[model samples]
Target: VALALCVIFNNSPVGSAISLIGMMLCLAGIFVLQQAHFIAILQVLIYAGAIMVLFMFVIMLLNLKQGENEGWASREKNLLLSVLTGFLAIGILYKISQVLFSVNMDTPASLPDSFGTVAVIGETLFTDFVLPFEVA
Candidate 1:
């Protein structure tokens, strides 16, 4: 919601870039909440920190200006689309939550402690997924 506001209210390229960075940070937080700490940290470092800085630099270099108010910029249509997308997202999350909760119907037990240390992640990436990691 806050991301949407940042993107909408901000017309400059730098503003858009910053808004995108905020969105990436939000996604990284979600990843962390889902127990994907490695991915979350990588997301923050790569997307929010490095890529966003590059994007801002490019935007500054370009010196782009926002377009003037063009015709057919209907607020009603935008509002409708926003509402629809919100409902869709909510529905999808509800379905995912239902499936996740249902998985433990038989035996409700805590998930085993998974090793999420940087060393363990580095070992997996360098050992098993070395080729893909290098390619990426």
Candidate 2:
């Protein structure tokens, strides 16, 4: 959805911003699915909130106008792209089908019960991730 918005509405800053927000939410959903609730919340709060606000501020301050968003290719080129995309989609579906036949999908045995807790994230943030966090 986000990519479609970006591609189809290249002339609109609002469209790009909305796409960015959608991407952030999708990332947050992936984090939640991975049991990283703290990271998911932070993703929405920091990247979606603060960074998006900054981007909008920059866009507003620059007073940028919409640019040309015309397609560069002819109908034949578009048809070729459509065919390639169809093949890619079929390949992706095939990979997903293979997952159903797989037998090994369990979590690693070394992962602790506290792996996804706020405390664990906090500890790691203040320790191993401290330098990068500070730099940021």
Candidate 3:
């Protein structure tokens, strides 16, 4: 949407603002899916709620209009760059999905007694390097 605002939509502030809202909503959804409910609430509250209202105020304060520009980038160059970027993004997404789908999930029959206990971590940190710990 950022690219679309700059290139396709010719830097329309309204379009950019809509895109920002959409992006923030998606981010909040991702946070919720990841079980980070608090962060998701914060994302919506801080970004979509407060920040967006502030952005709209700024945009209005600037008194922007779409018709005139200060000789922005050429449409042809922007189109070319956007196309190349799209291709690169597609390739990266493909690679990432391939890696993610290849993960193997296996559960061990028995667990270590102190796999992630705080005492075990404390012993490793304090006993293994007491001098370094004290120096820090």
Better of 1 and 2 by TM-score: 2
Deviating ranges (above 4 Å) for candidate 1: 1-11, 89-93, 96-114
lDDT of 3: 0.73
Tens digits of per-residue lDDT, candidate 3, 41-61, equal 878999988998899789888
Model 3 misplacement above 4 A: 1-10, 67-74, 105-136
| Order of quality (TM-score) | 2, 1, 3
How far residue 134's Cα lies from its native spot in candidate 3, in Å, is 26
| Candidate 2 vs candidate 3, TM-score winner | 2
Model 3, residue 14: displacement in angstroms?
A: 2.6
Q: Give lDDT: candidate 1, residue 98.
A: 94
Q: Count the backbone clashes (under 3 Å) in each candidate.
A: 0, 0, 0
Q: Per-residue error at 84 for model 3, in Å?
A: 3.7
For residues 66-126, could you state the per-residue lDDT of candidate 2 as single tens digits? 6565655456556766776788789889999898677466755476789899888789889
User: What residue runs in model 2 are displaced by over 4 Å at the alpha carbon?
Assistant: 1-9, 68-85, 104-111
TM-score of each: 0.71, 0.72, 0.55
